[model samples]
Target: MSDLWLFSFMDDELREKIKIQSEQTKAVVYSKRTCLRHNFLIATSKSYTENSILAYVDNTEMRSAVKDIQVYHMGTDILVKWQINEVPCKSDTFRVQLLDYKYQQFAETQAKDTSTVLFNNTSPEGIYHVRISWDVYSTVRNLYTHAVGLENVNHGVPAVPHVTDLGNARARVRWTTNPHCTPDLIHVHFREPSSIGLLKVIPGTDETTVITGMKQCIQYAIQLGFSYTTGKEYLSDPAYMTFLSDGTFHNAPKLSFDQNGSLLVQWLLRPGCIVNQTVVTVETNDQPAKEYNVTGDQPLARLNDLEPCAFHTVYVTIQYKNGNVERTNSSEIHSFTKEIGLTKIKTYIVDDVLLAHWESTQNCQALGYRVDLMNPTTGQTKAYLTGEMKYRVSIGECVKSCQLLVSAISVDTMVPVTTLIDVRPERVPAQPRPPFVRRDGPALFVWWTEPNLDLTIQSYKLFVNDSKKMIRDFEVKQPRRSILLNNIEENVVYSLNLRAINESGESQPSLSVQYKWNG
Candidate 1:
């Protein structure tokens, strides 16, 4: 028979041998054995409440203690068996590299009761595996699975675009996003030319990478993609790096200070590459002696008036890989002399909002101003004292004759950004006139001409009196650009009127049209 035997709670020396931390805690006890090969097995009888199984060590020289390794679920009471494979007689390192075996399960009948079964066994191919099964009512388990542990695994693919360029001598070397990227952690690695190459690390989601002062023949490649063609050599490796290209371009961008104190600049970069003003270089437009490095946030090489005509300009060049330099320049935008007198407001209908925009005429270009718009009915302030930035207002309606003011930079020399003024109803258009025609019959439709403007004449309004006691009015959708209002009532005498609508208010009624029922 098997050398192991099963036992239950009794009043032998067992109580003194096993230690329990609490009443609900399990007792752990082990007996030393020095036989050919020996082991310990402890299990529960039925469904035990605080269920736990412990592996006992009898052979002291073996690596056996595993802490907090829970082996069985408390849901079902399981009896587990322990076994020791043939002890390795070699070095400790060879013993530590030991592998695990597997087992299997089958339906086992004890008596009239049918229950579950579990065991450690082997397949026909001799690989180890475990199995678990349950019968009708009574199931027993010799639960010690010899499941084999994993032996092989590997890491994921690395990132992209190893080689890059930044322009006046910089290259934008962009790569793929790290899979381990988090809100605070962006994991990327780079190498420069020395043994370490020119390694630099930048954080955040901005994808394009820039390499500056790149040597002419120094090749650079990154670990990305499966097939990268490096001349005659075919690269099937994803992280292959190479330093050769078919051709190169030297078209550095050209930007100069414009009359508006803005940089008139241009350059060519690889499509989808990004550029940012993290580094800045400045040179004066007329004087070569006036040159220096300007901070990214600071404007202009030096501050002065007049040779400047209101602003300053500094030339900058960005360099890319393949030894190309693209030039773009920095612009110092100065305030303009105000020539703004009358501000023109036009309404544009968009998909979901209304927009009010204006264009500066003559000298108002570099100058700034404030625009105030309010509700006519509520007299509540909407947009007040803003910059000369033109944009569509979130506020949908428009009002007439509002207060607006502007302080000219030519006059004040103090306000760089502008002031207000007041405009009235006389500045806007009169309401549209209603259409007129005597209806000779139902099919006899006549067209009336109206001014082509941005005025609201939603539709035609017709008034008729069938008797002295009852007067009826009909409102129909306005006519198409063709001018005639169609589908009107036949043989009816109509007294027509018109009105214009805006945010301020509707215009007064126009001259009426008298129609006689000739039908």
Candidate 2:
């Protein structure tokens, strides 16, 4: 057995006892070794090896702490680099933790490489502490590095801004910040084209802003700047824009009614202005206001089913891009009226004259009543104008039927009422003149003349009485002047009387005439 180094300080007797126990158990002894030296002690047996002595001496120290830790701000990302005295093993890994200004760890990551990049776009502009740690031989090693201060880091100006001209004296400006840098303050400058006194400044942390109350169709100079908490400001490139105001394009619309009673409204748009939608408002007395939406390209609009004889007012508004609004002028009040027909129409005939009467029941302004007498058979019409409700027209004796139309006419519209009347002469023809009688062998001839043809006489009736006071009647269908009377007694005195007949019945008989008949 080799000398036991642990018991080397003991007496020879104790050492000899330890050696005897070691030899009896078939055990091998190991000696102490330094960290720089390699000492090997191996014990092997096929059987009864329960007394084997195994020892170890620990000389390895904890891996040297990471040195020369460095951090850099690369645009939108932060880069961390470190150096170590020894190469890392395959199982070794670095754990990086980020602490905010409050010393609170907000993020941690594991990496096998010595260098890493940290993306901190969402973090605010402030100092951050980074801690790097590793495990070596069951011992923990850690180091820390701080982000560069805001004063030492260089920042560029904000990106060039985009300007949108929203009509109605308004504009929108938008920009983006550099991903590598953070700004504590944002300032916007606006300069009018014509006036130096119109310069304005707006300060905020947002990247977009809206400016209002600008002149119409004028050019403006705009610029943006980014500043740090250290009161250092960097300005971006200047930008130019022109904002258009719709005030000059707004005008009153023309109002009128079409033939079909639809209200038509028309308006004009300002030059060089683009509109997305047009809004029309219609208002009437004792009614709710009506709204209508139409495309901006169309300048005309029509409204139907409006109340008659009512006043209405109209106005228009236009909507442009970016929610800009323009209000136009309102139209004058307009009155609408419609024509209503006449009522209570009546017609009568008396003494060969036709009379027509009607009543105006509608609330309409009329100039006068026009009466038209029409002969349907002859296709002839005659008109008469009168202010009164009743009209009288003479009809000749030969008229059979007639139509009367009474119309109420106004400056704007006209309404007519019609009626028909029978104008045929109902009286019998005048009594025929005194009939002449002539004697013939066993025959007598009689003839008569009509006074006028105005009466529609269907037939004529003649009454004859002999000398003995006996009466006999005869009829003639024609108005011929001569009629033959046969089968009369010879040399007998006869009295003849004539009467005219028509649809209205017979007329009075003519005077009796005495005649002698010879056969």
Report the alpha-carbon TM-score of model 1 versus the true structure. Answer: 0.24
Q: Whose TM-score is greatest here?
A: 2
lDDT of each: 0.37, 0.62
Q: Write the per-residue lDDT of candidate 2 for residues 76-150, one digit (tens) a residue.
A: 544455665553332246777777777687777776754553535434457767777665434322433344333
What candidate 1 gets wrong by more than 4 Å, as runs, is 1-265, 269-358, 361-436, 440-482, 490-510, 516-519
lDDT of 2 at 89: 31
Superposed by TM-score, candidate 2 places the C-alpha of residue 419 at a distance from the truth, in angstroms, of: 11
Task: Show model 2 residue runs off by greater than 4 Å.
Answer: 1-247, 258-261, 321-323, 336-519
lDDT of 1 by residue, 5-113 (tens): 2222221212222223333345344443232122232334322222435333222234321111111111122111123334431111100111224333322212112
TM-score of each: 0.24, 0.27
Which run of 10 residues does model 1 get worst, by summed lDDT?
Answer: 89-98
